[model samples]
Structure formats: structure tokens, C-alpha cells
Target: MAKLENLVQLLDRSLSLHGPRPLFGTKADGRWSWITYAEFGQLVARFRGGLASLGVQRGDRVALISNNRVEWAVAAYACFSMGVAVVPMYEAQLPAEWAFIINDCEASVAIVATPQIYEKCRDLPEKAPSLKHIVCLFEPEGPDGAPGARTTSYGALLAAGEKGPAPAIDPTAADTACLIYTSGTTGNPKGVILSHGNIASNVCAVLDLIPFGSADRSLSFLPWTHSFGHTGELHVMITVGASMALSESVDKIVANLAEVHPTVLMSVPRIFCRIYEGVQKQMTEKPALVQGLFRAGLRAAARQNKGEALGLVERLTLAAADRVIFSKIRDKFGGKLKYAISGGAALSYEVAEFVDALGITVYEGYGLTETSPVVAVNYPGARRLGTVGKPIPGVRVEIDRSETHDSRQGEIVVYGPNVMVGYHKRDEENKAVMMEDGGFRTGDLGYLDEDGYLHVTGRIKEQYKLENGKYVAPSPIEDKLKLSPLINNAMVYGDNRLFNVALIVPEMTALSEWARGEGLTFDSPGAMLRHPRVIARVQAEVDRCSSDAKGFEKIKKVALTDEDFTAENGMLTPTLKLKRRVVLAKYAPVLDALYSGSTKAAPREAAPPG
Candidate 1:
């Protein structure tokens, strides 16, 4: 409590000073239960003692494989309390990936959410030579048999700690707090070594900019394994005494929003995109008069967003529109959301504008896992519509334009307390990304404006040159295509080819509505994709979205699919980022056929307006 220096100290201060205050809310048996600060602290202490009893000494590594839950928080803080470096793995990741991370980090103890997750890593002790114990959060059970010799129930471990001596707590700012493995789009994931100061720096910086406090509450659904969710949502909320509800799943976000009526929401671009699409789809179903009213509300909101003073008549009309239209939109998000934070990916300009017009401000931020996950974010008073705002205090960002033709645009290099120490045990990988001045080369191409707002353009590695020698950034084009309500997810491919082609995943709900209107019937998504009418409709949407793109960047041919790219399918990362390599490999046949002109669909060419 004496001027907290490390993450453990922060947790202690929160417990002692904010005693008896409800910190976390979790649902069970159709009811919500609250865990107070003091209770949470006691649990952490017990868990720490339990871990220490199992020979989890200071500087030892522990791995946690779990979805977001109250116990996950308890386990993480317990690890930090005793100077144990927590290695968090996405529960949805392949078992092989899990084994690799556990072994790579040399974790000694593994804490998993359920028996099922433990089963995935059942052979981890053999795979990870250092692994000595496996703790299951749920009641101890094993898949198809009794619990393994090394396996113990979470409650039993806590009970062991409750009878042991108090856990030790002494950590320096430089001590590693967590090893968060990156969701590798290019290769195997690397363990990003974030020290206590690294994460604490980001939490303090964000708190300085945002007015979050005890009065605020949030419903959290972001995966805790991801740095963005861990440092940004959980740690930040805990640091400021904010209450959080552990959401059940992403699919239940809407229901949870209404149930919690949370004051703050943190999410990725996909959520906003889906919300915008749902709203737009609903508007289309409304009568012309209602649609006109919604449009008027949006116009007035846009004017106010631009700082325009409304005349008396305009103000009155705006008030009426907000009452009838915008109010309902707000209600869907629990009617009390102060603002939403968008990160994890580049939000489409259209989605941002549309959400803004609905009177809900979505602040966009930019960062990678290596920077404690938050380099820049748009604060309330100093936000630019499309740009990710200025760097946080103590963070330095410079554009390395040496390799780029454009002087203003280049790779973003960051030097700050939030930057990771280095990739754990991967010196060669660390050297490649680390600059002489200690800055981390982010590999994201972007430019800072005169106002200091950072505008991300694309991923340096994702950019590819066509056969005609024209370079195309697929991210921007994919983002643009997703703005259309019909398209949910898109992957652009044209590397060393004559032109770009795409694999598009349709928004099934919106597509169903349109199909119903067109008198189209299909038993399945695959059948729908094969229909000529459905194909032509999607083609028109692609043409419209690609109109502003460069000739070489335009999507020439597209293969539609009803299947969405998801973490389970190995097509998307846990954070919802598309895994380009996996996607291409999965759809190799379709892509090859698209390029060979063996498909019946005609290739669309991009031409300038007459």
C-alpha cells in the first residue's frame, strides 16, 4: 500500500485500501455472484501459498490455459504475487501450440479452466519436461479415466495454501510478470517477455488519460490470454477499482450487455462492424418514413460531431430524431455505455463513422503484443475520426521511412517502458526486431500527422507486389469490403499475379434477408454460394466496395463461402485477426482454380470512371 511499484504491490493496495468492495461479477446457476476485493485478495494469497508449496519458487514459470473467468484472474494475480511469471495460452489454440508454449517457456505448473482443456494438454508433462503439476479449476476429473497423478483440483490447491505459511511478495519493476505468446500470423508464436513495469506503465498511462474509477463497471468478453484484454481491460479496471463482470462468451455479449448495463465496453472492430450491420439491416426493414427519420438523426449527429452549431429548428429536429432512432440503438448496448474502445485490428472508416452517428463514441487504439499492447489511443477530448491518437505519455514513436518510397509513411518503431524486454530465449528473433537504440520495430506501416495522431496504413509483411510491379496492401481492401453489410470476412490474394482476387465470407443474417426479398431459397450456405443469382449479388457488392481502390488492388474474382474465419478453424487468431497463411493453405484449391480461369464466373476489371 506504500506507493505501489510493481504489479503485486498494486494488487495488495487494491485489496487493503479498497477492502470489501465488489471487484468481479461472475454468473453461475442462472445467477450472478460478486467477489469483493478482500475475498479476491485472500484467494490470491492462498493460491500463491499453494503454488509455493508445490515448489513454484520465485522466477519459476507457470502456464494457464483457460477462457475468461473469475478464477483466471485469481490465478494470474496469485502468480504475480509470488514473482512467478505467468504464461497465458489461448484455450482455443491447437494442442500442439499449447505444448510448444509450455515447453518454450519452461513452465513448471499448468492451471487450466476445465477437464476438457486439461485433456488437450494431458501429455504436457512428457512434452514439457519442466511441467511438474497440473491444476484444474473445475472439480478434478480426467477424460475417459480418473485424474492423472500430477493433476489436482483448484480448490484442493487453495486449501493446501490456506494451511501453509503466508506467500512471499517481493518483486522489482524489472522482474518479468508475464510471458504472452503472440498469435503468429507468419510463423510460430514468440513469447513476449513483459516485465512488471511494462504492463504497469500501460495501465498508469491509460488511467492518466481516461477517467475510470470505482463508479465504473464493465462486461468483459475479450480473451484474457491476449495482451490487449489482459493489460487494457482487466489490469486497467483493477488498478482503478472498477467493477467487472466476466462475460460468458462472445456470442452472448448482447444478452450480457442488457443484463449488466455496464458503464464501459472494450472490444474489437468485429463487434462494432456487426452492430453497425445489424442496425443497418433493421433500418432497411423499416418503413420509408422511419428510415428518413433515422437518416435525419445521423445527419444531425454528424454535424454535432464536426462541431457545427445547430440552428433552433435543426436542434429541435435533432432532439426528436435522437428520441425516436438513436435511443433504440443505445438501448441495444444496455443504454448506459459511456464509450466503447476498439482495438486488436484496424477499424473500418465507415463503421467508425456510422457508430459515431449513433451517438456512441468508439475510441480506436493501435498496438502490438510486444508493446504491452497499447502504444496510442484516442482519449475523449483529443480524438480524430480515423486516426489512432497520440502516443501515451513516456512512449516514443518514430517513422522509419528508410525503406519506403514515401517519406511520410514507414514502419512504426516504438521505444517505451511498455516495450517488452525481448522475445524469451529467441535471441535471433529478438535481434531482428530490436533496434540499436532499444526501440522495437513494430512492422506496421503508418504515418503520424502534424497533430501527432497515428494513422495505420497496413502491415509491412502483408503487402505484396503484383506481376505488373504494383504493390497492394490487402488489409485496406479487406477492411473496405467488410464495410458492406453483405460481407463479413474477406481475404485478398494476388501476390505476383496479374490482379487481386478475394475469398469472401458472407454475412449470413443480412444475406438471408436479401435472399428472402429476392424470392431465393437455399437449404444450405454452400448451395447458396453456388447459386448464380447469389453470386451475382455478391459480385455487385464487391465492385461497389472496391470502386475507390487502385486498379491492381481491386478484387477481380471472388469465391463466396458461408463459413466464417474463426479461432476454432485455425483461420483466425484469438484476437480475431485473420491468419493469412492458414487461410491460403485451407483454400488453396479454390485460389488455384480462381487464377486458372477454370471457374465459370467472369473476372471483373477495375476501370476509371468515364
Candidate 2:
């Protein structure tokens, strides 16, 4: 393959090389449909023409609001191919967020997924005066369902494109290809303007690290609007000629896994954690003999996964276990899964180990939107268990020690072609994040080990100080808490307080089963949370999970809640990351009670089983 100068050239080369190969697949009406690379290219050309007919030219911004769908891919590539910068927004975000992003980007054209999305941002022109056209992916039911006067159906746009001239534009690698907004955990989202070269460099570097080919197929469910999914899965898969099946939804991932039977899977850690919990839960219901065999297999595999030489006896035992036990676990993932890529958050070590023991390699990488989302990743032969592997080829990573109080680790900074130009129109914000030598300061606190593996500890901004002047990193403790099957989500509190405390969201399914076994009954989620038995059980789990933490880091008190923080509730980002500030504000009363010494009930004697 030639060194592609820009994204458009990459796309053209890919199409020429894999024109007849299946590129994308989707399920509709209980059937699977596929589009070849040639067909997809044609769709992109038509969309490009359509966009051109709407006066979308080079340097123009086109905002797209949609879930993970074929149209999202088509629109994004169309915009990239024509030198128009894409601004992707989560379809489910609030109207206010949509308005803010649209106005901030000064988008001239908008492509929406459905009438609902169009309606959500119909008044966008009032807020974003630059926005001139609204294109809907699906037709509206009636005039009332139609968006503002500027809106047109996606089909109509394509039909008009058939009569319009193909857009003629030339773009350099430095030209902005996309503007990905941050999830805005601490404040309003800022647009990270990634250039064509930035994304192309990342795609090329990642390809050199992770192996993919025409034979590989992937099931993609991660939100396409996010950088991780956009660059890692969509762009990487397309560049490599691998087929991708668009999942119906996140809730249908397990079913789609079987139906798609993908050779590769890309997802966040939460999905893997849930799979680990589900597997454990199912095993507990099996016969003792079955459970014993599974545990024996897991033990044997774990030793091998740790790079320990297995004795002949252990090797033979593992081979037998693979046939009887591990193979069955692999069968759940279509029995052909070769690799699973985890990113978007720190995958728990336990879950990663468990999946690796099942004979599937889980490569956990780390990056940010500003870095075209891939700075480091664990490849097939160079994986480290606990560390996010070495930086991809051509990227330079350095630990900045000046800002850290501890000399061991500091902010992880990057200098690479993959790094974004800067945040769009936020010179002050960009100045704050950009280092003296042009390195993008990743707010994550981590250190590089002797072997060059990156160990991300926690977020520097997320660290909090206690009344005793001890600074605590919450993510590490939260990761531990989530390892407990009884706990789903947790937020560690106590910034400038006596000791660390946590607001925990119980794994309702597991908790309900335990409650049933204990003869406990509750009508509502709030009532269940307030129950003495539930609180006691949660506290015990919290203590057990946080046992490895230092004295100051251990969670002293906890408040249980049945409500899981979600993006819809403003407690989590669209990508499922917790919005710490939002969560703190939402749970103010609970935190106050814990610190004020009003809710310190002793844990009951009967602790839930692991």
C-alpha cells in the first residue's frame, strides 16, 4: 500500500483495492443486508454531490446527528471526501447541547437521522444562524413531523444529487476533516478539530500494530459519533477491507454477536465487565461439577495468560479444559472471535484476564479525542496485562512531571501527527492544554513502565483533597468497587472532607435476586435503596472491594441508590463516562448526610456471596 497523503486518497485507494468486497452490513426486517465497497463509494459520491448542491464547499462545517447507522458512515465520508469538516453529535443529547455545538462549529449544513432528531434541532437556525440546510435520513410522517422550512428528505437530496455536478475540491492533509466535541464531564463540550493528516496518521499507525484483513469481520455497536468508534472501528475496518455489521442497538449486542459471528469485536470496558458478570452469574446456577471444571480451566488459563511456563500436567489439563469448558464460553462469542479491542475507559484487570483465559485476546488501548483517539494500544504479540501497551509507531509519549505532586507519575502528554490541530475557536483553552513544545497534554495521570507500557492511574482533574490534606484518585477506587457484581456504578466523594465516601448504584438484577433469597421486598427503587438490608449488603461489598486501598483511600461510608447514572439523566456522558461534577451536584444531599455523620449504620452480618 502506498503512503496515503490524505483521507480522500485513502478512501479512493481502498475502493480500488476492495471494490467487490462487502464493506458494511445491517439488520432490517429480521434479515441481514450487505453493501459492497463499490456500492458504498457510489453512495458517498452521491452524498458528496448532494452536499455540494446545498452549497457545502471546502472549509464548510457539516453537523451530523445520528446513532450508529449506515447513513452516519456515508455522511461522514462524504463530508471528508469533499473537504468539508464533519461535526458529529450524539442524537440523544439535549437540544441545548445540539444548539451549542451547532453554533460553536458554525455548521452551514446538518444531516439528521430521523424526524425526531430533526424536530429536536428544528429551531437550530434560530440559535445557529450559520446553519442553512437540514437534511433528514428518513422521511417525515406528516407536515407537522417535518422540521423547519429548510428541511428536506434524505432520499430527495440524493435524487437532486443525481442531477447535480460532482463536487471538485482539493484538500491538504492539514485541512480539518472533523471536529469531535468532548463529552463535557466538567464543563461545556469543546470541539477538538482533527485534521485529515491527524486521523490518517492514526489509522496507519494502528494498522501497523493491530492485524486486520479482508477475512476479518467486526460487529460495531459503539456510538459512531465518538472518536474511539469513529477512528478505531469504522475508519480502521474500512481501511483494512474488513466487513462491519452495524448492530441494531447496544441492548441487542449479545444477540447480534451470534447472528453476525464477527471475527473481531471493538467495545468499551463496560460491555466486557457485563459479560464477565453474566458468565459468573450463569456459572453459579450450574451444577457443582460444572462449576468446578470451569474454575479449573480458568486457573490453568490464568497461569498461561500471566506468561508463566505451564508444567506438562498443567498444559494437558488446560488442553482438556479448553475442549470441555473454555470452548463453550468461546462459543457464546460465535466460536470464531479472534480479537476483542477494549477502549473508552480502563478495562478492569479481572475482566481482561477472564476474557484472555477464554482464548480471546483483549487489547486495551488508551487515547483521547485530541490525539485522533489512539496514542497507545496492546498488539497481538506485545500485550501487557495491566498496562495500556506501547505507543503506536511515530507517536511520542512523555510523562510530564512538573505538574504532579508525586514524582512517580504525571500527566501523559503526546507529540505526534495524530494529535489534533487544536480545539476549534477556543484559543485560550487550547493554550491551556497545549504544552510548550506542541505536545497535547492529556489530563490523564500515568507513567511508562520500564518495558514502555503505559499505566494510566487516574485523571489529574478528578483527584480530590481530603480534610487531612490527602489527595485521593477516585477512578482506581471506583474501578475496584465496580468489580463487585452487586455494584454497577460508583462515584467516590469527599473533596475536602474527613474521609472518602461513595454513592453506589447497585446492580439491580443481582440485588433483586439476593433480596428474594433474603425474603426482602420493596415496591420502588427508592424504597429498596433505603432498606436497611440493602444498605448493609452494599457497605459490606464496598469494604471488601476497597480492601487493597490505603487507609485514606478506603471508602469510609457509602449510600446506595437504585438509579444508575445515565446520559439521559445528565450524570453520565453520551459515551457512558461519568460526569463527576454533574453527579456530585445530583447527589449533594446524600454526600452531606454521609459527611455530617447522619448515615453511618453498621453493616449487617450476612454478606452477599461473590
Give the best candidate by lDDT: 2
**Cα deviation of 547, candidate 2, in Å:** 1.9
Q: What are the root-mean-square deviations of the candidates from the true structure over C-alphas? A: 4.2, 3.6
For candidate 1, the 10 contiguous residues with the lowest summed lDDT are 601-610
The alpha-carbon deviation from the true structure for residue 282 of candidate 2, after best TM-score superposition, in angstroms, is 0.5
The TM-score values for the models, in the order shown, are: 0.95, 0.96
Which lDDT value does model 1 have at 375? 98
- Per-residue accuracy of model 1 over 1-610 as CA lDDT, tens digit each: 1234578877876777677888999888888899999899888888888888888888999999998888899889988988889999887888999889988999988888877786677788778888888888988654423233277778987899999956567789999999999988788899999999998888888888888888788899888798989999998888878889999888888888888888888888888888887888889989999899888878777788879998887787779888998887788788988878889889887788788887778789999899998999999788888888899988999999987788799999999999999999999989999989989999999999999999999999999999998877899889889889889888999989988888888887878888989999987666777777887788789999989887767887888776678888788887778999888876766766778874433211111111
Give one digit per residue, the lDDT tens place, for model 2 in 1-610: 3455577877787899899999999998999999999998888888888888888888999999999888888888888878899999998799899999999999998888876777677678888889888888987665543234377777776777778847645569898999999999988999999998998889999998787988999998888788999999888888888899999888898889888889998999989988998899888999998888788888889999888999997898888878987888788787889998999889988889999999999899999999999999999789998888999998989998897867779999999998889998899999988987879999999999988999999999998899999888899889889888899899999888989889888888888888889999887666667777888899899999988789999888888766678899888899999998877766677678887776632121211111
Best candidate per TM-score, number? Answer: 2
Write down the lDDT of every candidate, Cα atoms only.
0.84, 0.86
User: How many pairs of residues collide in each model?
Assistant: 0, 0
